[model samples]
Target: MSRGSLFQRAPIPEAKFQKTEDVTKERDADGKKRINQYVVGELLGQGTFGRVKLCHDTVTGNRYAMKVFRKQQLMRKKDFQNEGPGRGMSVTTALSKVYNEIEMMESYSCHPRCVNLVEVLEHQDSQKIYVVMTLGEVGSLLTYDECEGTYTAPVPGEWIPASSQSTQCSSRSSTSRGRSLAIPEPIAKCFIKDALEGIAHLHEHGIVHRDIKPDNFFITTQGRVLLGDFTVASKVDEHGRVRGTEGTYSFMPPECCTPTDESQEYSGHDGRAADMWALGVTVWVVLFGSLPFQKANLKELFESIAECQYRIPPDAPVSPEGLHFIQAVLVKDATNRLTAKDALAHPWVSTADFSQLPAYIEAALKVKEERAKKAAEDASVSGSSSFTGILRP
Candidate 1:
């Protein structure tokens, strides 16, 4: 808990639960399925591996999100052969990725901005692993339809120029409806701040959350945003670099799309800077309700990302400060991009009024400032390179 030290891991207890069939069939007087000491209710959400269900502790009546991953599906060879992030991953590697997520969550359980893990349950016979976590009743930022509603078109009289050759590729519609709807400024600031806190926490521990899109950020019923879903997260090397181009294509940085060095299949990149780039894209998505870089074809999409071919619609409702913050983090050269700590000190986030901010946000802001100051002093004394290389006007 001390400043400058990595966040300590809280003990996460593992339990052997009842047989899956019995647990699913046995119902209490309330008509809810019994899952050991917890009563399982409706399904909350699902993913490629398994589904998350709402469950309550019989002893404490406290609600939690039970993430159930099927061991069989996880070990499936086809899944490993998929062309994306999981390509050519071995069975052992896939299973280890799940445990890594649990360990990361357990290690940072005490951090308010990161989701807390209560306990883990394994049913070997049932081929399932159950991870119990604090519930985000309001769901993820993606769950808020209002925040993703259609954007207002530019005024009729406004003279909007045609797209340049760099961005003239065919536009691909997002899977989500109303993908161009922008979240209000105040609300977007709060969400982005929460995300930065989570990112900073991971980076401070020498880890990088390779995947940091909006879907990974969950919102509690209390309106506090907690970052979750670490399936693809990884630890950085001593030099703060990580190998491989892991993450959603649209969120990946320019270097990830087209490696700076083509000699190696997977070149090392600044893990922390890659995270900041993803955060920048997340911010852009939340503020504009549309991807800054989009294309109908996969190759073209990657090309656009590598070229840093994106533009803010002239009618985007973002403020000058917000625009500056986005530009700062989304720099084409990762070396010049803002670090999560530096991002917290950016004018847009730093100058925001804290009176109406959530308690967690206020606390995170204070911690960010303290850490930024310490980092700056450390860099100066050791003549270490600062992540904030040069700010663009």
Candidate 2:
């Protein structure tokens, strides 16, 4: 079929589609790209950058996650400095920088726990880039905090973290058991470990997730984790970049909490340290079922994280070890914070007895399953039921 008219991801009849093993990546006249016509399927998901669809390799009959990036949507967001809500983004913002995210995601496709970056293709005449990737059902591990709606795969540089972060996905608000938002603990742990494995793989390969939060994680039906969205990813350079803050306000590390020396480029602190900070926040969310610095507004949140003065509430259930783990990574001083390697060795996580973790996970799964079954029954009995939270960062 010609590569001209497909738009959003819509469901296709199974009979009209074919799947294949050999991928179809090609270049057309003028060398632009003709990346269309692979038999799109059901809408897997949608995010700020683009949408993911379950597609079939018309020739091989194999399944793949087809990610489509809208050049214009990103372009509009590029000039974010002007938007009332988009303020706080660094000055000198460039629309083209997003390509870096695409490249980052594309390069690390083969790492096991990391989501595979398969092939990147462009549309016939538009600026859209069609990225073919492997689907991570229980995508990266955004704790229960980021798990409001669904796991939406990000574009290249917009790396989705293993911690389920739902910064903008309001639908993922948490449950504290109030018939409104009861967040159980075991499921939270499953999200944490799965995310750790994905980040562990990335750190092993010298790639720092830079941004790690609840929204970035994606979960599968079986609860596997996949670290995703590598858009802001940058190599750790001894010398920092001269400018730009490429991160969500809540997700930015302690250093980015406030610029120290703009002339020297604040990015030097990039790498495992930043990732750890994100993890610290994610862990807080998992256990508390909300942002550690949940404030009335951004200014308050910034001040709280900046002063490192947030409270853990005397009545909270956070473990001492868990508290230690959070402190280890959240240290404002880069030198004092826990590296990814050090984090893996920390007593809180290591000595927690993972042997019991699986049982906890199984129990949580059962809870979710029961919830789903009852919802189905409720739907059948009277078109009405209840709800829950999300995943992002």
Task: Evaluate all candidate structures by whole-model CA lDDT and list the values in order.
Answer: 0.66, 0.54
lDDT digits (tens) for residues 194-260 of candidate 2: 6676776565544667767766666554455566767667544333221334566776666666536
Query: Please, what are the lDDT tens digits per residue for candidate 1 over residues 6-92?
Result: 233224334222223334337888777876788887676766556788888888889988887777667662323222242334334
Report model 1's TM-score to 2 decimal places: 0.72
Residue 163 in model 1: lDDT: 29
Best by lDDT: 1
lDDT of 1 at 379: 86
> Which whole-number lDDT from 0 to 100 does residue 28 have in model 1?
89
- Residue 173 displacement (Å), model 2: 26
Model 2 whole-model lDDT (C-alpha atoms): 0.54
Q: What is the lDDT of residue 224 in candidate 1?
A: 67
- Model 1 lDDT-worst window of ten: 152-161
Clashing pairs in 1: 149-181, 179-289
